[model samples]
Structure formats: structure tokens, C-alpha cells
Target: MKRLQQLIRYSTFALGLILACSFISERNQAGAVERPWKVRAYIQKHDFLAEALRQETGIPKAIIYAVAGLESDWGRSELAKNANNHFGIKSKPEWRGLEYCKPTQEYNGQQMVTQNDCFRKYPLIRRSYEDFGDFLMQSERYAILKTLEANDYTGWTDAIQNGGYATDPEYAHKLRGIIWRYQLTKLP
Candidate 1:
């Protein structure tokens, strides 16, 4: 009986070691350094954008990060493809007042064709935030967000959902998950 118990203990130790090694190997394979580097670069590029939005709208930087992280994966989203509109906001009829770009698109799997679509661009990151605020403020559907302008992420989430910003049912939960996972509410 003593030998059997010893054998069980050794097996448990080996299993634990294997599990730990597997976890570490998976983390390394996920490109850990690249993940942090991408997030750091995103903040460096758009810190001014967050500041500008804060000045105009009183939204917290953490909330902004949460939104950006979920939408664009710290600006590494495949949707950008290159043009830098990381939020996946498609140009629609409501954006008529904003500037339009002749972006190429393949409709229903056809050849690329030019379409007049609204996109926000800025010579500076500050201007991008200013334009984003303007876009949000101008939309009647987004009026619910106005009440959430000051440091309320739950409110912001509900407002965005109410405004039809995303149909993905998990968007808010995912954003909240990222916010907590990164502890984005904490100081840098």
C-alpha cells in the first residue's frame, strides 16, 4: 500500500510538471512579446487621440482603450487591411456630412470597384479623436451615448448597443473581458 501511494504521488508530480510546461509553451507560441509591443505601439500612436477625446467628451482613457482593443485588437485587426480605420466602421448613408474616400471593394465576391465611403483621417492623432467625437455627436441614434460621456463603461456599452453600433451579441462582454484582463483601468 505504501508503494502504491508513492507511485500515485510521483504520477501527480509528473502530471503537474507536464501541465505547467504545456501552459508556458502555449503562451510562448502565442507571440507574447509581439502582443505587448502591438498594444504599446497603439497607445503611443493614439495617446493624443484619447486625450483629445477626454478634453471634448470627458470619456475615460480606460474606456477608450477597452473599445479600441475590442474593435481593433490594439490596432492589429485584419479589417484595417492597411488604411488605418481600425474600428471596422463602414461608410453608410448617415455619414454624408463627413469626408468620403473612393475606397475599392469587392461586392458579393466580384472584382474590386470604387465606392464613395466615409472615413475619418487625421494629419494628427488629436484630430482623429476630434473627428470621432463629432461623428458620434452628430448621429441621432447615438444620443444615448451622450449620457455616458463621463467615465462609465457599462453605460457606454449599453449606449453603443442601443445605438446599433455592433450586432455582435458578445461585444460588450468581450470589451469588459479585455478591460479586466489587461487591467486597463490602472495607471501605466
Candidate 2:
């Protein structure tokens, strides 16, 4: 009986270790750096483009910056590097542009689900930022964001999550963490 309990405990520990390693490995494989400063530098380098988009579209650059950082690791991920898709905006059936498909993890209300999703592809990095702003501006699901005050990164973050821009329940929190961690709100 003692041996049976020991076996069960060992099995549980092994399963948990495996799952944790897989999760971290996948995140690392996505090209995110382990250091926070790298993300800040990356965001700074790309802020010019996101700032331009903000000016043209009235979307907060901070939100754009954080989402792009989280989704594509500031343009280092395979999807972003190969296809210029930094925002991870999936392709809809109506999409007529190029597409890139990859395995991604999404939340389906109750749990994390991994599936191959088709992402919108752009020919240029600037185009990707432009399309990302346009997506939030034109979609009714994100209409509420347009009404929020400019520079309200928190509000923008919340609305983006509630609008289903991402499936993770903690999507907004993660965005906010990055924004706060790197002082992204300091951006003018």
C-alpha cells in the first residue's frame, strides 16, 4: 500500500515536470528573450512605426506596443520574421492576402487549447502595424476602445482582452505586466 502511494506521487511529479518544461520550452521557442531590457529596446526601436499608426488611427501606441511585444517578441518570432505579422492577427475566411499557419495555444474558456491557426501575412513590418491598428479601429468588437482616453493603456488592455483579441484569460494582465515592467507608459 505504501509502495502504491509512492508510485502515484512519483507519477504525478513526473507529469507536472514534463508539462511545465513543455510550456516554458514553447514560450522560449517563440523567440522571447529572457531579459526585460531586450523587450524595451525592441519596443523603442519599433515605437516609431507604432507611434505613426497611433497618430493615423487614434489607437494607443502602448497597447499596440505591448501586444506586438507579447505576440511576436518584438518581431523576432518566426511568424513575424518570416511573414511580418507581429500582432498575431489570424486570417479570416474573407482574408484575401497571404497567410501563415502555425501551431498556437489559445484559451477556450475552460482550458488551453493548441491548434494550427492561419495568421494574416504582410509584406512589410509597417504594413503589419497598420493592419493591426485598422483591425481594432474597424471591428465592432473593439469599438469601445475607440472611446477610451488616449494613453489609457490599462483601459486599452482590458478592452482588447474583452474584445476577444486574445483567448488567454490573463492576456490583459500579461500586457499590463510588460507595459509596467518596461515603463512603456512613458512613451509619448
Candidate 3:
């Protein structure tokens, strides 16, 4: 009878542990669910500028939005907040504009390494979007992306990734996912 009581107590403890773990998992999932709403809000706030830039530069608005969204963490990154640099455009030696220096992580073929990098700082968010368009237009490496249809965000993402816009091997995949998940292609 005593052994039976001990077994029941152990089972109760295990059950409580399982319930706690399940609750924690649900909380994490809830945060994931909330992220889409945040991204959507970001898109809504910036879609007009993205569309304007797209019309001016012929770069797809979806590509612009997705790249900015990913690079800037939906405009919540320190670079975006402080520098208005939504595209993560690093400072070049020839850059004659203000720069913000910060520690950033870059994949070094083997692993991500943190390094101090200087990024362009913009007086206005519009300037940041415009500079991103200019960067793509002027870079010979991304010239292939310009020939694709304006609505072909997938092709553009693939070309941008191929053009070494990011070190992440899954950069195109993530951009495509963001475009699809948020229906960015439908934006004007």
C-alpha cells in the first residue's frame, strides 16, 4: 500500500512537470503568432515609401519591404531606430555621409562572428530606402535582378542572394518566406 502511494506521488510530479512544459511551449508559440502582427504593422507603416521607391527605381516593392523587414527586424533594430538604415547598408570608404558604428554579427564561413562595423546613417527613412535602391542599381553584381519583372520578387530575392547581398545561405529563402507569409507581393 505504501509503494502504491509513492508511485502515485511520482506520477503526479511527472504530470505536473509535463503540464508546466506544455504551458511554456504554448507561451513561446504565442510569441511566434504575435510576430506576424508586428511585421504587418511595420509593412503598413512603410508600404507607401516602398511603393514610391519601387515606382522610382523599378525594384519590386515586395523585395524592398522584405529586405528592409528582415534587415531591420521590422524597423526595430538599433540600426534602423538610430540610423534610419533599414537595409543594413554598411559604410563604404567613399561614403561621405554620417555613419553609425556598432557591433554586428557576420557569418564567417564557419560561424557568425561579431565585429564592429560602420553603417550609413540617414537623416530621413526615405533617404535610406532611396540609397538601397541606388545601391542595387549601381552595383554590377545586381544588374541581372533589374531585368526581371517588377513583380518577380522570387527572382529578385534569388538574384540578390546570389549577388552576395548577405552572408546567410538561406537569405533568399527567408526573403521569399517573408514575402509569402505577409502577402507583400499584393502591396501597391
Which structure is stronger by lDDT: 1 or 3?
Answer: 3
> Scored by Cα lDDT, where does model 3 land?
0.89
Residues 60-137 of candidate 1: C-alpha lDDT, one tens digit per residue: 777677777776678775434343555546556554433425443423333345565555433443444565566566
Model 1 RMSD in Å is 8.3
Models 1 onward score TM values of 0.60, 0.78, 0.78
Report the lDDT tens digits of candidate 2 across residue range 1-188.
99999999999999999999999899878854454676767776888998899889888767888899999987789999988999999999978999999899999996999999999999999889989988999999999987999878788899999999999999999999988776666676
**Greater-TM-score candidate between 1 and 3:** 3
Pairs that collide in candidate 1 are none
lDDT of 3 by residue, 1-188 (tens): 99999999999999999999999789867753334777878877998898888889899888998899999999999999999999999998989999999999888784888999999999999999999999998899999977999877778999999998988888899999988877777665
Which stretches of model 3 miss by more than 4 angstroms? 1-35
**How does model 1 score by TM-score?**
0.60
**Where does the lowest 10-residue lDDT sum fall in candidate 3?**
28-37
Q: Which candidate is the best by TM-score?
A: 3
Q: How much is 107 displaced in model 3, in angstroms?
A: 0.8
* Model 2, TM vs. native: 0.78
